[model samples]
Target: MPDPAGQPPPSSHTLWRAFVPRWAYMPLSGEGAARFGGRWNPVGQPTIYAARELSTAWAEYNQGFVQHPALIAQLRLDAARLVDLTDPAELDARRIDPSIHACEWRDAMDRGKVPETHRLRKRLMGEGADGVIYPSFMSPGGTCVALWRWNAPGALRLTVVDPDHRLPKTQASWV
Candidate 1:
């Protein structure tokens, strides 16, 4: 909510991500979404989707269905050039509707069509957005962020809360 007037996200904030155990070690990597695609990114685009709240991250990970093993991590998100979909003014300036958040991406992909959300994300990225913050679909009133790039010129910084180095050092643990 720091930039309702079309600026970056807060100077800093906390976000959460619940990752599958197989990919837990690489919590910051967007490879999963890159390979599988997501509501905000096309199959070849990388994205790290996280929640503004812990419970919302859990809900987003399970997607209102069966619960499974997960490695939830707290992330400290730093200054970001983001697009706030939660703000009507921002969306209006982009000529995007709020309904883009609830677009049925899977169904559109099933029909071999591009979902509007993906298109919107693509357009935003082209316009230099590091990510997008929007209302969560599974958790009402909660917010979520879908980050597309990091370590780039004018990109955001996202780090995991593993101060003790307890997590795996390499992805081989999952391999």
Candidate 2:
């Protein structure tokens, strides 16, 4: 759920990757730089730096950065966002592949009834936030539909993996 301001809760422990142009390093200012000092000493003009966590001061570092060889990084667990799945009903009405809502699909599979164009397979939930929304192993991009095969006996625990909004298959066009 979003905070009172309708924004994802502020993160304290999530790791962040900031791609700093060689020219921008000296000017970069944040608690991490103040505490750890500039680790990227402007070697090749462009480099990725792993900031300690999300901070209002690091307002410029919201985008994902590509992996780099020389940069060291760590993820902050304190600021991790919990998956918001208070309503799985919404997904059920939308993204599930219409061809397989019943046991017939499974029965067909058992009988070697595979199709030529697209394969119909069992649904799977991912390990983290993407799982809450996508819940299918067949596709990595994610679908709005989920077949919740199992539930924890009393409570639910979800981990946050990415902050960006991933569109469900229903609302997104996939080629």
Candidate 3:
């Protein structure tokens, strides 16, 4: 990792996410979220969502409704540049109110208005942040990360946790 700004990353982190088995081969893909938009991203801006803990991942995926079988994955993030939205000091320094954590992005979108969360993401992104870590609404005390860029130059590296070639590589797995 080349440090152009001469600053090393704060640390490495591991995250967890659950997806449909058909999309297991493309765990890093954010096209689904892009098409529909999410709490952290507006429509057309792809974002990968992950949790700091496995239980939190399950909670996020289930969301109180019965869901189809899922493939839970452990993800690795290396030297990633992320802003912790849950940090009070950072929020105060950035002049952002903590109420954003409870933003009703979906309802706002349904009402044809841009969500505050979307605006927050745009601002942080423009400031060169790769992603954000915020307290999860689905899981109390749980933290989640929303990444827009990874595994590329001038960005961080993110990898799935398949060690023995267990996950299928071809798209045929989707069929």
Candidate 4:
């Protein structure tokens, strides 16, 4: 089953590849850096120093650097945003919110599905899994008429046949 954000569950590999290197969680495409020591250094230097300090402070506050619950929670949230899960789901028959589910879906997608060739697939995956993925028919002005496949016993399969040749839009709804 997919995570809330429609991704697979998190694993050590996912955590390391997606989170540890980016432990500082630096902002992208801006001349800004994380504030530390009441002064701002260049994006890289100051943030690195601040990260070290934060790690130390976190260790001091939590009595160890390993297994800090708050840091772990923050990392999980940040990782979810990074991988674009941000959806809720039922796992083992229990409901979970988007943030947690996104984390899971990301892990699954990273390890499981090969990237899709369809334009919409790129858009939906890029947008943090909020977009829907189902078969669709083409309409005038290049709109997709999607058909959702619900989980049911012996559900009837529906197919859409588009006579008009319309290009599928690759735009992501959520950035």
Candidate 5:
């Protein structure tokens, strides 16, 4: 997929295999943390099973953010016609406000489209590490995915998706 202006597209392996990195930075504002009940913490270190769930959740979230508008519109337009089929009571109960849903979807899409930038070298080093041993860093636009999963009855899983594949893997590895 092509990267949006001011946003980097995820690497193939990252898209298919690992957690996105931007998630690591979130609960960006205190509001986000409050939305999730409080300060967020990972349940455990990254693992293969957690990674798989992360990928699935991220895929679902991204698809929803991207397609919610169209899907909501189509569902609303068809709701009247579908009302008579099979369970009428069930259909009525399941009905959603098209306009409201559309608005929400649009808002989500807008938020998703916003770009995130990071100063890698500066972040890795200290704020005043100019001319230090660290290499020069370049700022780039990037997109990220956040996935939350239920690892067990009471355990939660969190993963971040880095579109640019900027995270370090095993020693001596490169993305």
Candidate 6:
């Protein structure tokens, strides 16, 4: 993806992943963590594709989404973390179906195409370091997907944080 505001693209070697407790099913201890991921519940929750750079994650999460307090704290402290899923087999196992596409929200809204989906499958299929790292279709400063992989417990290391701790207000940046 082209750098939107003259900013450099993310480093080719590293990608970040963000988690929200409610959406991500991270178990305390078990193999099930390997299956941790979000679902595409259009009626319940709209499809969201995002990742990378703590600041970008911050902007995405703090965009007036009105998350639960506990979840907010959890995200602020630990849900967002760096990840490395360089193995092709590991990444393939968690790849989203090639047929499932994501919409470009802005374009759709501007053109009055409310529920239209763009060629997301095509974009995600494009090459990137380790996997696919692309700019977010929703947020300018955010990445939509990094590494193009998920649900690999052995590859992810979630940081544990105090659920009650609150992040400084300075971190909340709205789009």
Candidate number with greatest TM-score: 3
RMSD values for the candidates in order, in angstroms, are: 2.5, 19.6, 3.2, 21.5, 20.9, 12.4
Better of 2 and 3 by TM-score: 3
lDDT of 6 by residue, 26-94 (tens): 312222222432221112222223355555555555554665332322211122222223233423444
Candidate 3 Cα misplacement greater than 4 A, ranges: 1-10
For 87-137, candidate 5 gives per-residue lDDT tens digits of 333224434222221133233434553111112212211322111111011
Clashes of 4: 12
TM-score, cand. 3: 0.92
Mark the 10 consecutive residues where model 1 has the least summed lDDT: 1-10
Q: lDDT for model 2, please.
A: 0.29
Which prediction has the highest lDDT against the true structure? 3
| Full-model lDDT, candidate 6 | 0.35
Using lDDT as the yardstick, the better of models 4 and 6 is 6
Model 1 score (lDDT): 0.84
Poorest stretch of ten by lDDT in candidate 5: 71-80
| Candidate 3, 1-175: lDDT as tens digits | 2135522234579999988788877889988899999999999988999999998898888886887588999999987778788888778767779999989999999999999999988887776778888998789999999998788786788999998979988779666
TM-score of each: 0.89, 0.19, 0.92, 0.16, 0.18, 0.32
How much is the lDDT of residue 147 in candidate 1?
91
Angstrom error at residue 136, model 2:
16
Clashing pairs in 2: 12-79, 13-76, 13-79, 15-76, 22-45
| Model 6 CA lDDT for position 11 | 38
Off by over 4 Å in 2: 16-68, 73-175
Give per-residue lDDT, candidate 5, residue 30: 21
Question: Candidate 3: RMSD over Cα atoms?
Answer: 3.2
lDDT tens per residue, model 2, 58-112:
3334322443322212323333333223235433432434333222433443455
